[model samples]
Target: MTPPPGWYPDPQAPHLERWWDGAVWTEHLRAPEVPGPPQPAGGVSGRAKAVALTSAAVVLVAAIVTGVAVLGEDDDGGGPATGALPTSVPSTDLPTPTPTRTTSEPPADPDAVPDVVVDELNGITLPLPDGWTPPKNVPEDDVVMTTDDGTYECPAGVGLCRHGLVLTRTVTENDEKSPETLAEQDIPDAADAAYDRDTLDRRLYGGIESHRTVKSGPVAVAGRAGYFVRWRVKTADGPGGYVQSLAFPSSVGSESPVIVRFVFDAGPDGPPLADMDRITKGIRSIGDADTGGGVGSSIGPTG
Candidate 1:
């Protein structure tokens, strides 16, 4: 038998009620009842009311006497009855509290994390956050990928690249250089090429100038030493752009060491630094002992 309906529990929101128009669900929703202000005192007979008034007077008198006694004990003569109970006099002009509408804000969504992808040739893996396309095979030992629909353009004079997220992975034989040396020298040099003020300002930001290297520092990646660098380009008329770069040596001591670099660019909207940090932590070599890899202990790089 079909049940007549007015409102029923919403399948999507367990605690909320949704309107059912006897045949189908409606968009209308019914908010849960909120408690109201306390009610005024009531339900007393004339005789009881008189008795209550008498009892209240007695209590007030007793409180006043107690206060007087306390004041008498103070060595500095007598004082006002500070502890006396106040008498409640009925007033027709007194106002009742009015009810006000109130609502609670909805909860925020959970933080998103990236997906992990392994470069079969290098035995290394890194996270590819949600909304990003899977890695596509590239020439030689390189793979490339991007966020889905990750294309954006800064007006002509703002930045070099007008686009969305672009991630590239290229594994080159480690030149036996310490990660520090590689980061200290190579990252700065790369930043110079990527963010030449004249070239960028000439194209974007409407002649408004901005500097590079908002922040840079040492960071560990995939259980190995690495470096992180960030650059910002602000335009006079637009939201601006940000770039983050990271590089680490895949196999620290192998005869054929590998260097891995990951760069992220967010135009105007800015980069998700925290999400990027979490992604960096998730990076790992498929076979390194420190990172649960099959490789045993390896020698540390010498200066």
Candidate 2:
């Protein structure tokens, strides 16, 4: 009798099993299943052993057929075997990954103010007049424009000095917010810093001898209401100079008050007093494009 379709030990390859299509061996093959413990061969003839082995093989094949039928019933009928895993199935429940982004500030335009000194902290720009340029060796945050005549021996015999100096800085330590009040309060210190004495208490401008208010009034600066206090200072040894403190609210940031201090030697060599008015008129916000005369323009004493 012919055997039913099932996996059986391959006649050509004893280590593996081949498929029998109920009549002949098919090409499919698989590893043989693990064998049971050895049966006792004592007192058994070779023929009898063969008969027993044939019967056991038939039983095993029938059991394998039953297992396959059960698996087919559990799976989608005539589809893949039960419990088989797919190669690559995408999941709908998981979130897709997103890429990260970065940002930065834009670069400043070089052509915006080609001939000015920009003070970024105070959000203002000071125009460099024909005979003036930015001073070297000054603090990074302190903005100063001075006469191109450069540094010279101080008449007071203390340190190097510039004949004309215009310095700008933000007022952070003071509690006063009024532009007029702050301007008035800053003039004395501005004079002292420029003419009276150095940080080492050494005399400057031969030590300021006497100072009288030359200009004091409400004014407009950089399109904002402001005030300035200018003084004609007398020094002990060299030509005396003028010192002025101008205060205004910043156009950018937290709108903090800003102070600009001006110092000019009192002689034929010092920067012209008219330059003071020119610089004052030229004061503007960092990015302002207006070239017209500044608001509330005022010219200082020429002599």
Candidate 3:
């Protein structure tokens, strides 16, 4: 006959007790309880009570151990059991951050000089002499300073013209050429652009009849050694004019060659010739610092 539902010795694990549910053995298990003293006068003895309490304590501890094993199997597929503390996943490798670079030089000052025109685009500054002012209609990339007298009817009877003009720009197209070669090649074009013809193919100065070199040599401008070619052109009408092409490496960016063109009516009405030298001397970096070698000191010809 099968035993009733109660603790009994396990056949598989002899050291532990298994439950018999009348029909078959169940998974519930515990330790076997030890016997106590016999009862006296139909009342429970103190030793019997003590044995019952000890057995109950042992059952409670066994139940807790079995429950913890079940929880560990459910959570981690038979891994070690853990307490109530939360667990964190392992972190992945992260990329290091890049460091930023900083400069020690102070910022440029705009009001470092009086009566100056700052060409922030070209990274240079020019002295605004008494009679010259920045032109409004010119493109922002090009720097132009014209006489205060402004435009007048061209001597060639087409469009308007200025008696005195100075323009500066970077030589982007053929900047690979040397400053001297660039200056020499640019003077003839400068003459045509200033005195010979306007953009519309109209003879602004009645067209250039002839041109002769007035000065051609090495010169210092804004502390950089450079070259200049000045030409006295005779036009078909009007009192002709002088055109000059000055080329030097910029002190600020890429050291690219910069060209400054000067066109002035040849006589009392135009700006004085000495103003050219004065303007060259006054040229400086935007911050009023001399980064180039020497300012306006003419070194003899390279030839």
> Which candidate number has the best lDDT?
2
RMSD after CA superposition, every candidate:
23.1, 21.2, 23.0
lDDT of 3 by residue, 137-237 (tens): 75323546888787888887777877788888888886365888989888988899888776667897788999998888888777778888888999998
* Better structure of 1 and 2 per TM-score: 2
Q: Candidate 3 — which residues are off by over 4 angstroms?
A: 1-114, 138-143, 175-177, 289-303
Instruction: Please list the C-alpha lDDT of all candidates, in the order they appear.
Output: 0.48, 0.73, 0.72
Per-residue alpha-carbon lDDT of candidate 2 for residues 1-303, written as tens digits (9 for 90 to 100)? 444577754443443456767655566777545344555657666876787677667655754564455444533443223343233322223355999899988898874424788888888888888888877675323547878887888887767877888888889996788988998899999898878887777785678889998778876677777888899999997898999888988888889999998889988889998777778777888778473335444533222
How well is each residue in 185-302 modelled by candidate 1, as lDDT tens digits?
Answer: 5544334333333332354434335647666665666555666666665555555555555666655334233444434444434445455565666667765525732322232222
Poorly placed runs, candidate 1 (over 4 Å): 1-114, 135-143, 157-176, 192-210, 234-239, 252-271, 287-303
